[model samples]
Target chain A: MKIDLENLTIKKAHEAMKNGGFSARELAQAYLNNIDKDLNAFIVVFDDVLEQADEADKRFKDGTAELLTGIPIAVKNNILIKGKKTTAGSKILENYKATYDATVIKRLKEKGVVFIGGTNLDEFAMGSSTENSAFGVTKNPHDKTRVPGGSSGGSAVAVASNYALVALGSETGGSIRQPASFCGVVGLKSTYGAVSRYGAAALGSSLDQISPLGKNIEDVEIVFDCIKGEDKMDSTSIPDKIYKEAEKDVNENKKIIGIPRHFLKEGIDKEVLENFENSVNKFKELGYKIKEIELPNIEYSLAIYYILMPSEASTNLARYDGMRFGFLKEGENLLGDYMKTKGEGFGKEVRRRIILGTYVLSAGYYDAYYNKAQVLRKMIRKEILKAFENVDAIITPTTPTPAFKIGERTKDPVQMYLADIFTVPANITNIPAISIPSGFVNMDGKELPLGLQIMTPHMQEKLLFKISREVLS
Target chain B: MEIKDIENLAKLSRIELSDDEKKELLGEMDSILGFVEQIQKVETGENVSEAGDLVNVMRSDEDTHESGVFTDDILAEVPKVENGFVKVKKIL
Candidate 1:
């Protein structure tokens, strides 16, 4: 039997596979047939796809199948799977192979899920566009001239183009949700520490969160359930009990969504803002109250993210000293070896961030840039908490504009960072936020997808899912 | 920030950027630093130090001592390993 793979959720795949409608191998092959290699979405397509599918099929026959059993999922290249090349889209680690499965991979493997491949991302998950990837840019499925959004651009594109049923993307300040917005798919930036970061390369330790991108919110939640839990390897991973408490406390009767009107005043594309307004009206039509609230520190989010992310990223990336693993280049001396290997191995954007991070973290500038940003981070969190007191969640356009041309903002680093303005607040405040396809905007006779972003207080994913469903449906 | 500042940072960061790259970095850093200067006006209360609510999580210092767990697999991925140790350029 044939089916629409674009709308096929994990639950539907399970039923189809159980009834012998199609073999897992057939599903896997069907996806492989539709892939366009020029899109450059995947870094590596595992050769053992059929073997993994056969294992999942055995789980079904043995009645040990879980939700993701026999399902083909695409993961960002940063998440490690044992015996696979996890490049993090950088040449430095291009030859490196994982010795152990990341915590998320370990969990998924136990449930008999089939990993189709690792998708392309911005090198070390540093940039807002996939153009920074050493491999190539992942063109948006809607328009080849436009980017898929990044550093999780490939995962978003994979789900948007129906190359994978659902994909896992990691966000270091809007990497997942922004791309999901641009590509016109559903992406969730799981609350900081809500998912394990044990196996993922650290971009910003305080801000990075592994997330899910899917065709819809329900599909995203299904993957979230399979992957969300505390791990011994990640000390920051939150307990299921914290998430459950918020889930149980959700008040279905009085659901008030907050809109920070101050943020919408300037710098947003006209069509994107119109689409955002239409989404707000849709929420109102669904029996939810909408309120305008004040988040005074909202404007500082972008500046704060640049400072904090790079500071942490510099510290995290210091491990790639061309010593134990990854790329190496001998020089005249030890310092020269270190400088030459790094200068050659890393891409342009990665080098810029490393220098920027080092600059901010240096002794004299630390108080001015890094420490101040941390204090403002707390202020942003407090402001969000205050806003939540009056509303169940906050709504905004996921991106100021949708899917700009690949090279549009590459020249200006600050302009590129501005693409993440609306989504970075949730990352700073450690809140669960989801980017659901709001509608489409016409650009030069082509329909580009726009996303409505909803951010709820910490561990409040249930509210995000409920509101996203109301808006999406 | 100037080209000299960029050079200092490049040296500190252990990245051997070319002179052209250093000039480009100086201009970029100048603009970025100018943009982030607005954050200085925020009046954080006295004695606000920690970035977030996170604290160091301590675990007992005892090793369970599982033998032959992942030593071989890890060593296999290292670029240069000699006598079960990862080889690196001499520090001195």
Candidate 2:
């Protein structure tokens, strides 16, 4: 009964529910009561909490409930839930209610998952920390002076602080995994095109992906199974025709994991390096062979990410002009209205990316910037594919450092982007990756949580989950 | 990028950025562009990496759909329709 709704992983709660100890409403009330008090972790807790709880209660009572039945989940503000005010931690759409449920919302609703509320995030998922959010930065629940990692910072804190039993986060350039790492939780960035992007606001469209944030591996897999698969509305969605679960007896096999030898060369914090080595040692103890793999191009992940990401983001965000459905014009002329609305509505980081995106994709620069990034992206993907042939999965640190102060990197955008150093590589190459809390670091007498990131080949999510669940348990 | 330059880019992007926003964005733009510029320095050996691989993603000019689209005729269904469209304001 004393379970902090924020810290309790969904898998533990579900196991308890399956045993018939607590009813659905009881679980829903635990989360709702916390949301009403902890205004720091959540933005807008759902108003119809009771109704969804009642529905879930019915399904559970009749023995027809889904795995997520009666479980309370919080969604990052970027993902749409029907009639919910999904702000994406931005003022431009602060008052805009979602007209339609995102594909993830629709799927979760059908399976008796009760949405508790929307959590805060960096505006458009742009920052390494939540300070870039217009909604005010989401504080690290572990230490208030520090930050929760962003742009999925709120989703991370929701689970870390027990504000919600589990939460959903989107990852583009380490948003989900980094936040999860900072908050000491489980986060997964599904393979590109694995989940439908029907209603989520696009940041860097090419890299933007819907993913899950949970307390642990089992919980992440449950949410992943519920929300994944193709949707007609999302053209990028890949059909779930090729999924296979790794056997529970997978430990007996002499599995090989690739470790980018070059990743250890520069910029990694000592704590990060130590934690990674300890994780590798643990994996070896579990009878897995660690292969020192050469991915020379892996060092260039951030360079490629910024180029392709901004270009795609520039195109994806072009629809939010002041004259259209969301934030629109209120000036003397059409162009004036657009200028004023977007100028006032967007924050500094958002505008910076927009300009960068436009400049790269503009006249006389398309072939040189955009097209060439494509060719390089293929080379990187090919390297990952070749690496997979020698190893079942790739292992790396989720982030280079732990959580820093609120404004530590606000002045330098490159410093912020460096936080994605580890997670972004998996995204650029279209692979499934998970970040699990490995240990905490003592940085000058401060405790910082670190994450061990495990990545599997394209669409090899079951194998990814199998490895993560081992480390998590 | 200068503040003025950022304002111009905002116009091209169709988002209204305020003066304060412009000043702040100018600072951010300098750093983002500075980082992106480093990619220009990284040796790719005659191949530069782009942002996406959807090289030939083609959406054909297929037959027009009949559902969920707002046409002039559909706008006429609203009792407050104006100028053959669903209209709202006349602000100066």
Which candidate should be chosen as best, given DockQ against the real structure?
1
Give each candidate's interface RMSD in Å.
Answer: 1.3, 5.2
* DockQ (Cα-based) for each candidate: 0.70, 0.34
Question: What is the lDDT of every predicted structure here?
Answer: 0.89, 0.79
Model 1 misplaced stretches (Cα beyond 4 Å): B45-47, B50-56, B61-65
Index of the highest-lDDT prediction: 1
lDDT string for model 1 (A1-473, tens) is 56679778988998988888887888888887778998999999999988999988888788888778888899999999999999999999989898888888988888888898999999999988899998889999899999999999999989888888999999989999999999999999988888999999999999889988999888899888878988867888887777687778877765898999998887999999999989988988898899999999889998999999988988898898888788988888889989998999999999999999999999999988888888888888989999899998899999999899989999999899989999899898889999989889999888999998999888878778987887777
Off by over 4 Å in 2: A1-12, A15-19, A36-39, A244-254, B1-7, B15-27, B41-92
lDDT (10s digit) by residue, model 2, range A1-473: 65545446666667667777677788888766665343366778888988988888888678898678888888998998867888888778877777678999999988888888888888888888888888787888777788889889888988877767789999888899999999999899999988988899998777778999988777888898889987767778875554434233234353898898777768888878989999999998887888989886777778778888888887887766644355554767666666667777787788777788887788877766766666677778888889887888889999888888888888888888898989888899988899999999976577888999999877877788878777666
TM-score of chain A, every prediction, order shown = 0.98, 0.95
